[model samples]
Target: MLGGISIWQLLIVLGIIILIFGTKKLRNVGGDLGGAVKGFKKAMNEDEKGNDKSTDDPQARVSHDDEGTTYDVKAERKAEEQDERK
Candidate 1:
């Protein structure tokens, strides 16, 4: 009656799964899954918060690269400030 399977058929499948896996293994699997979800949510929230803060303050911005060369991100800002002084 549901998804091309009857209620009794569904119950039988469920019973077989429980018999094979047992409740203890199922419980541990559920707990591990829940922990992973929680960790992912926490990481996402922290990243969002960091982005929000950096957008409001230019000095808080950061640039990353794999090479040894270094770049100054605030060079433009310094130029603007110098022009303003003149």
Candidate 2:
């Protein structure tokens, strides 16, 4: 009997699993389970950081379009219009 469940019950459940999936397949299952655990840990870490808004320390700066560009929006539009006319 299992320490909790009866030994027979545990054996039956294990047998069912082995029948449904061979041992080799079950071995690969561990890798998938480990990956899921790792992903969950990463998501939790991200959430913890997401809740802290006071931290403005960015590891890298991602600039949007024209973020660092010197071109003025109005001048660019006017230049495009002039080019179209030509």
Candidate 1 stretches with Cα past 4 Å from truth are 55-86
What are the per-residue Cα lDDT tens digits for candidate 1 across 1-86? Answer: 67799899989998998999998999999999999999999999998898878766666566565578767769978998999999
Locate the minimum summed-lDDT window of 10 residues in model 2: 54-63
Residue 5 lDDT (model 2): 92
On lDDT, the leading prediction is 1
Candidate 2 — which residues are off by over 4 angstroms?
Answer: 1-5, 54-86
**Global lDDT scores for all candidate models:** 0.88, 0.85
Error of 2 at 46 (Å): 1.7
Clashing pairs in 2: 1-7, 2-7
Clashing pairs in 1: none
Error at 65, model 2, angstroms: 22
